[model samples]
Target: MAGIGFELRKMMRRDTLTGVAKAYLYAGVISSGPLILSIIGMLLIGVLSLGKVIPDFLITQFQVSVTYLIAASLILTGFVQLAFTRFMSDRLFEKRIDLVLPNFNAVVLIATSMSGVIGLVLAFTLFADLSLGYRVLMITGFVILSNIWIAAIVLSSVKEYKHILGTFFIGYTVTVGAALELNRFGLEGLLLGFVIGHFVLLIGLSGLIYRNYPSDRFVSFEVFDKRFAYPSLIFVGFFYNLGVWLDKFMFWFGPGTGQQIIGPLRASAIYDIPVFISYLCVMPGMAAFLVRIEADFVEFYDEFYDAVRSGATLAHIQESRDMMVRTVRAGLYEIMKIQAVVILLIFAFGDWLLDKLGISTLYSPLLRIDVIAASLQVLFLGALNVFFYLDQRKTVFSLSFVFVLLNGVLTALTLHFGPGTYGYGFAGALLLTVIASVYLLDRKFEGLEYETYMLQKS
Candidate 1:
C-alpha cells in the first residue's frame, strides 16, 4: 500500500502544464461519469422510444419537455460552474489550497440548502405546471446532488488521488440503480431515479472529499473580496452559456427556409429528433480541448516561475511562445480525431438508427444540424480556451458578445424567414464566430513578451 501510494503520486507528478492538464482531464472524467452515463442512457431510450415502443405523442412530449427542463437546469447551474471554477482558479493562483475548500463548503451548503427549500416549495406548488409533479420533485433532488458533485470537483481539481475513482463508481452505480427504478415509473420515474442517484452519489463524494482532503491546511484569515472572484466568473460564465444556448433558442424560435429545417415547436415528430441528438458527441471533444489548454498553461506557469526564480531576463523567457501554439495544435488534433469518429458513426448508421429508435419525422433535419454544429463548436471551444490561458479576458468577452449577438440576430432572421433555416444559420454563425474570436484573441496576445513579464511579475 505504501509503495502503491508512492507510485500513484509519481504517476500524477507534474513539472509542466501537462501535469495540471492531465489532472484536469481525470477530474472532468470523474465528475462527469454520472452525466456521461445518463446521456448515453437517454440516447438508448431515444432509440427505444423513437420508432414505436412509445407512441408519437409520447415521443413528441418527451422531446419538448426535456428541452425546457434541460434549458432551465442550464440557466440555474450555469453560474455555479463559472463561480466555482473562478474560485478554484483564484485559490490555485494564490497557492492557497485550503481556503478553496472552506469557501466551497460555504457555497455548496448554501446552494443545496436553497435547492431543498425551493424544491420542496415547488414540488408542492408547481404541481399544476407539470402533469408529473414527481418529476419536479426529482429535479429538486438533482439540485441537491448536483451541488455535492460540483463541490467534489472543486476539491479534486486542487488535490487529486486514486480515491476519486472509487467515489465516482459509487455515485455512478447509485445513479444506474435510480435510473432503472425510475424507468418503471415512466417520465416521473426516470427523473426520480436520476434524483435519488445523484443524492446518494453526492453523499459518497462528499465523504470521499473529506476523507482524502482534511481541513488541516485551511487558512484562517479575515480577507474577503467578492469582486475578485464572482464578477469575472459571472461574466465569463454567462457569456459562455449564452453562446451555447443561443442556437437552441434560435431553433426554438426560427423555422427559416428549407424542407429539412425543423423548428423546435414544429419538432413534434420523432424522426426530427435525431438532428439534435447528434450534437452530444461534441462534449468529448470539448473535454479534450479543455485538458490540453490546462496542461499548456501549467507548463507556461512553471517556465515563468523558473525564469523569475533564477533572475532570467524577460526577453530570455519571452522566447518560449511555443506553449500557446502547442496548446492550440493539441486541441485541434484531439477535436478532429473525436469529431471524425463520431461524425462517421453517425453517417454510417444514422438513418437506420433513427428509424430503429422511432424518431419522429420532424427531427430528421435537426439531427444533421446538431451534429454539424457540435463538431464546429468543438474547435471553437478549443480556441476560446487558448485565449483564456493568454489572459485576454477582455478579448474573450468581446468575442463572446459577438457570438451572442450574431446568433440572436440570426435567430430573429430565421424566425422572420420561417421554419428550418435557424439551425443552419445558427451553426454557421457559431463556426464563424469561433474563427473570428480566435483570430482576435491571437492578435490580442501578439505581444506575448510583455504579457509574460507582467504575469511573472505578479
Candidate 2:
C-alpha cells in the first residue's frame, strides 16, 4: 500500500506533457458534465420548446443579446485577462504564495462587483423597451454565468492544476445532475446550477490550493507591479488577438464591410456561422493545453537556453535542437490532427447542423481558409509558448503586425470594392503570413510571440 501511494504521488508530481495529458483527461471528464450538458440543454430548449412558445424573432434577439454581452465582456477584459494569468502564475512560480491570496481575493471581489454592475445594466436594457422579458432574463443568466466562468479560467492557469481538475469534476457533476432535476426553474435553474457549481468548485479548489500551497511567506509589492516584463505583453497580445479576428470584426461591426456583394451574393452571410462554430471546437484544445503550456515553459527555461549558452559542442547543440524540433513537431502534429478531425466533422455535418437550426446560410469556401487559420493558431501558439522564454518578443510583434497589416489592407479593399469577399480578408492576411514565415524560416528560424509567455523560473 505504501508503494502504491508513493507511485501515485510521483505520478501526480509530474506535470509534463504526458502528465498534462493525464490531468486533462480527468478535467475533461468533469468539464464534460457541464460543457456537454450546456450544449444539450440549449438544444433541448430550442427543440423541446419547438419554436411555438418562443417565436424565431425572440430567439434571434436572445442570441444577439447573449452574443453581444459575451463579446463585450471578453473585449472589455481583454488586456486584464491576459495579464491576470501571468501575474498570478509569476507569483506562484517565484514561491511567493502570500501574494496569491491577496491577488485572488482582490480578483474575486472585483469580478463579482463587475458582474453586479453588468447585471444591473442588462436589467435596464431588457426592461427598458423589450417585450421578450423571459428570453431576456434567460440570456442575462448566461452573461452572469460567464463572469463566474472567468474565475474558473484564471484559476486553472495557476500551478497544481491536476488536483484542481479533480475537485472541479466532482462539483461540475453535481451541477449537471441538479440542473436537470430542477427543470421547473427554467433558465434560472441553469444559472442557479452554475452558481452552485462555482461555489463548490471555488471552495473545493481553493481548499486544495491552500493545503498544497500555503501562503505563509510575505511577498514583495514588486511582485504585484502591473508593469513587469510579461505584464506589458497583454497590450501587444490584445492587439494581436484582435488582429487575428480583425477580419471577422470588420465583417460584423465595420461600417459598409458587410455591404460587399459579388453580383447578388453577400459574403458576410455565408462566412459568419461556420467560422463561429469552428471556434467552439477550439475550446477543448484550449482547456487541455493551458496548463501544458506553462509546464513546457518551465522545461524550456531549464533546458533550451541554458544549454545553448553553455558553450557546448556542435554535437550537443544539435542534440538539443533535435529535442526542440521534436517537441514543436509533436505539439503541432497533435493539434493539426485534432483540428483536421474537427474541420472534417464541421465540413461534413455542417449542412445538417446549420439547416436544422435555420442557419443554413453560413457555409462558404471560406470554411477551408478559416480551418487553416484556426489550426495554425493552436499549433503556433503552442510552439511560441516554449520559445517566448528565450526573450523572443520582437519577432512575434513583427509577424503579428504583418498579419494585421495584410488583413487590414485586404479587408478594407474588399469592403470598398463592393465585392463579395469576407474570408478574403483573412485569406489575404494569413496567406501573407504563410509566405513571409516560409521565407523567414529559410533564412533563420524561431518566430515571434505577441504574448509575454514566461511567468517565472522555478
Candidate 3:
C-alpha cells in the first residue's frame, strides 16, 4: 500500500492542481477500489432488482445471503490473512520470492478445505429446508469468497493494482448481469451468479499471482512450515477481524435490534444500513493513510531501521529516529485533516442525500456517529500498521482484544440504555482505542534509541 502511495506521490510531483487531484483519485482507487466496487455492485443489484422480473422478496433474500457471505468469509479467512501475509513478507525479505506463490497456494488450499467443510455443515443442517441445489450453491459461494479474500490480501502486497481493479470490474459486471439474467430461477439463481462471478475473480487473482511467481510444482504446504508460521500474527489477524465485526454480530442477534432474515441467519435493519454507510465514508481516510503513512512514515522507517542494522554512528541513528517520529506524526495529522473535512461534508449534506435516496431521516444521527467511528478506525489501522513494522505483536493483540471486548460490553449497555444511545458504544470504543494507540506509539518511538542500543546489550 505504501508502495502505491509512493508511486502516487511521485506522480503528483508536478504539484499542479490536476496532478494533486489525479494522485488522490488513484490513491482512493488503489486503496479502496475493490471494496467500493463491491458496495456499488451490490447496491446496484438491489436498486435494479426493483420493478424488474425478480420478485422483491427474493431480492431481499439475495441481499441478506450475500451480506452473510461477506461477513462470514472475511472472519473465516481473517484467521490466516495476516499470518500468510507475514509468511510471504518474510520470504520476500529473504529474497526467496520463488517460495511465495507456492506457500500462498498452500495457505489458500488449507483455508478452502476448512471453509468448505464448515460451509457444508451449516448449509446442510441449518439450511436443510432450502433446495439441495441452493445449499450447494451457498456453500460454494462461501468457500470461493473466503479464498478470494485471502488471495486479495497477498495480491495487494504485490504491485499489480491495475490488474486487480480490472478483475473486480469484470467479475462484478458478470455478477450483476448474471444475477439479473438468471432471476427466473429465484434466490438460487442469484446465489449461483454470485458464485460464478467470485470464481472468475478468484481465477483472475490466482492467475496474476501465478504469473508473477511461476512454479513448476503443483502444490505446496510450506505455509504450515513452522519456520515460516507466525502464531502471533495469526492471532492478531483473527482477533482484529473479530473485533471489527463483533459489535455488528451482537446487534444482529440482539433482542430488539434483529430478526431472522433467513434460516439461522439474522439481519438488523437499524444497525446494518448506517454501519455500511459509515464504512463507505472511510474511503478518504483510507486514501490518506496509504498516502501519508505508507509513503512518508515508511520511507523514514526504512532509513532508521537500516541505520540501526548498519552500525551507523549514534548521531546518525538518532537523527534517523527523529525523522521517523516526525514522519509518523505528520502522517497521522494528515489523516485527521482529510477525514475531518470528509466528515463535515457528510454531516452538512447527509440528510439531503439520504432523502434523495429515499432513506429515512431516522438513520441520519447514526450515520454521523458511525462516520466518526470509522474515521477513528482509520487511525487505529495506521497505528496497527506501525506496530507491525516494529514487530510489536503483543501490543497488536492486546489492542485487538480490548477492541472486541470493549465494543461488546459497551454496545450491550447501549442497547439496554435505549434508542438515542445506539451508535455511541462503537464510537466510544474506537475513541478510547485511538487514545491508547497514540500514547503507545509516542512512547514506543520515544524509547527507540534506548531499545535499539541498550536492549541489545541487556
Q: Highest TM-score, which number?
A: 3
| lDDT at 10, model 2 | 44
| lDDT (Cα, 0-100) at 409 in candidate 3 | 87
TM-score of each: 0.76, 0.66, 0.95
Kindly provide the TM-score of model 3 when superposed on the true structure, using C-alpha atoms: 0.95
- Considering summed lDDT, which 10 consecutive residues are worst modelled in model 1? 257-266
- Determine which window of 10 residues in candidate 2 has minimal summed lDDT: 1-10
* Clashes (candidate 3): 0
| Regions of candidate 3 where Cα sits further than 4 Å from its true position | 1-6, 14-19, 456-458
Total colliding residue pairs, candidate 1: 32
Residue pairs in clash, model 2: 395-448, 396-448, 396-449
Residue-wise C-alpha lDDT for candidate 3, range 1-458, written one tens digit per residue: 35465566676677899877767766676677555566666777777767764558777778888888887877888789888877777777787778878787788888889889998888768888877887888889888888888777777666655676788778889888887777677788777777787788889888888887777776677878887768888778877778788888888899899888778888888988888888888888888788777777778888998998899998999899899888888878888998899789879988987898889988999889988998999999999999888878889888988888888889999899987888899889988998999999999998988877787744
Give a tens-digit lDDT track for model 1, residues 1-458: 01122222343475567765555555356434444445554555444444442344443344344444444445555556666665566666686656665666666765666656665666557543555555465556547654854655564463444556666666656655665545645555555555666677677767755664467644332123555544555566567767777656545543332222212233323223544466556666655554555444456645755775687875756654555455566657777787778778777777766687665445556566667777877677767666655566676677777777877887667667655663675677777887796677566557665555565553
* Model 2 C-alpha lDDT per residue in residues 1-458, reported as the tens digit of each score: 01111222344478577855565554334333333334444444434434343344333333333344444545444545545556666665676666765555555555556656765675566444433544345344544444444455444544454565567567666555554444345444444544455456557765764564456542334434646546445564655666766676677655553433311112345456556555556655543343234333244334655665576665665566556555545544555677678778767776777677676444545565566666556555555454354444555557667777888888888777654565666766765675565454323333211111233354
Ranking by TM-score: 3, 1, 2
| Stretches of candidate 2 exceeding 4 Å from the true structure | 1-53, 110-154, 157-213, 216-231, 254-271, 283-301, 305-318, 344-366, 394-409, 412-420, 427-458
Better of 2 and 3 by lDDT: 3
Count of clashing residue pairs in every prediction: 32, 3, 0
Residue 165 Cα positional deviation in candidate 2, in Å, after optimal superposition: 4.6
